[model samples]
Target: MSIKALITHIQELVSAQSGLAGLNLGLVNYGVPTKLPAIYIDGLTFLDDKLNSHTFNLCYVTTDLSIEQLDYAKLILAALQGSPCVQAQQLLPRPEPENKRNRWIIPCVFFPRALKA
Candidate 1:
């Protein structure tokens, strides 16, 4: 399946599992209204697994309330990783800007992989 299709499926799965209605899981933040207690998942990428030729990298950004909520989000991400659609999963920290000092910035991507051709 294509990476776009895979991402859509992952978003659907997450929404269904988290009981979130009308969640928009797109690459760009287009002012989607999210209810509190909802988790935001983004920055999904697929890359070559450098250590293993047979596998690929599935990286994404997960942001939520607290550490516990982040853990839950990770669990949800882990479940998605187990699917055949994904080769492997890696949890990457979203990079913070050097100047702007907002410690509570929602997770985002610094370096993202290009879509496979």
Candidate 2:
């Protein structure tokens, strides 16, 4: 799906809230390879009332997949890199699984354009 569509969907899933929080959801038939079966996301960062800095805490969720872990990671990283608003992107430590399954969580932060000095 297009980035615009994805963003819209995310906004809907998370709903309108006042605070810093993340939202995690799945992405199916995303036109990507099998390695990347799900799309984990955190809450979106937006300018707060103060207009001094962005407000929103990071959140994450995982989805089941039928592909190599490394490949999935690569796809997510690539997608984030392509985005214009994302910055200081990085992956967090892998979480331990309760059962035998393949999962990956890609964490990233979005920083809006700063005012010109």
Candidate 3:
């Protein structure tokens, strides 16, 4: 799938989740927002020369200091795993936020039909 399509898929998945309705979601270029519980499309990488295999990051930030951060990651994984295009997904190390927020990135890979062969 294309990058735009992948982004749309992520958005749809997040929206369909149980408790993410009020969360602030955006793209990486939008910069660090003042809102809590935010998600961004941080980065995208093509794993192959043909762009058929791709990996992207879901950057999630929140002010809550508890393990609630993991819920978002799990929700993302659950949604992505249902798609045929998705090959794998992983959670990266939690990064120190600029302020008093918890930040993490969920990386996911997609192998389009062209590369499924």
Candidate 4:
């Protein structure tokens, strides 16, 4: 899938979420957001020369400091974390923000798809 398609897929995945259904989600140019619980797909990239692979980050922003956000973050992680298709990294809390912040970021990789050589 293309990058745009990947973004759309991510959006769709989150959009279908029952809890996060109406949350503010979109791409980011790296700026201060004006909303809470802002989930953004950013840092466009692919992990392979074939350009069939994709990797990006999800930043979950909210003032609600707790593990509750993890429920939302795992939605993406679980789907891609399966087997052979995609690889998902751990969703960790930001190092700063007093070790208890409002944002958690997960770096996920849609590993390179094997194509006939």
Candidate 5:
């Protein structure tokens, strides 16, 4: 399948969650949302194992960084991990700048050969 299809699948899964009902999701190189709990594709790479690694950023844009931001990111991570369509890899926490926003970089791999094009 194409990257767009993967993005669509992830959007659908995240949308299905009541807690993330208002979360804004977007594609990378397009336009990322300025709102909190916003998720967007960050990068994509082809693996030698016939899999594609898709990197996504789940971010909370806030002037006041708190534990709530981390918690929300965790929730998103859970939803992403629960997806049966792709193999969720890892959720890497970004180092906070103390004055910058909080974000989690998640990398998920999917076998393109197994998915219908």
Candidate 6:
């Protein structure tokens, strides 16, 4: 599947959760929301794996609540890790300088190669 499909899936999941119902996941170029608990795809790239597929990382930006952010990250991880096309992932505590937006990164590699058409 494509990166947009994965992002759409995560967006759906985040929307379903009442606690995270308003979270928005978008490409990094999309205007950042003036809200908390948002996610953005950092970028996409081809992977060097045997599958020769694609890899990307999603940045989960939230408020400074460590526990709440952890919960949100866990929810995101669970949603992403459950995808069959997702081969692997590593979620790390990623901090940033923009408005104290606590961040977590979920770097993922997926199959169904993104070779040149």
The lDDT per prediction is: 0.38, 0.40, 0.64, 0.58, 0.58, 0.64
| Per-prediction TM-score | 0.39, 0.43, 0.69, 0.61, 0.68, 0.66
- Quote the positional error of residue 111 for candidate 3 in Å: 2.7
Tens digits of lDDT, candidate 3, 1-117 = 556666566667667777665555544322455565776665566656486677666677777766766776677567666667665466665856566677777776766663333
The residue pairs found clashing in candidate 6 are none
Tens-digit lDDT track for model 6 on 1-117?
Answer: 555666655566556666555445443322355566567766677655555677777778877755666877877777767665664466798777565668888887766543222
Give the alpha carbon lDDT tens digit for every residue of 1-117 in model 2: 133444443343333332212322333222232432344444434544354334322223244433445544544555555555443366553543564344454554443443111
Model 1: per-residue Cα lDDT over 13-95, one tens digit each: 56555422333334322222243333333444334345222222233233332354345446555555544444334454443
Better of 2 and 4 by lDDT: 4
- Model 4, position 61, has a per-residue lDDT of 74
Q: Return whichever of 4 and 6 wins on lDDT.
A: 6
Clashes of each: 0, 5, 0, 0, 0, 0
lDDT of 4 by residue, 1-117 (tens): 555555455555566556665545554323346666676665657445476676667666767676666676676456445434446668866634564446767787664453111
The C-alpha stretches of model 6 lying farther than 4 A from their native spots are: 13-19, 22-35, 47-50, 113-117
Residue 82 Cα positional deviation in candidate 4, in Å, after optimal superposition: 7.2
Q: Candidate 1, residue 92: CA error in Å?
A: 2.4
Error of 1 at 2 (Å): 3.8
In model 1, state the lDDT of residue 30: 22
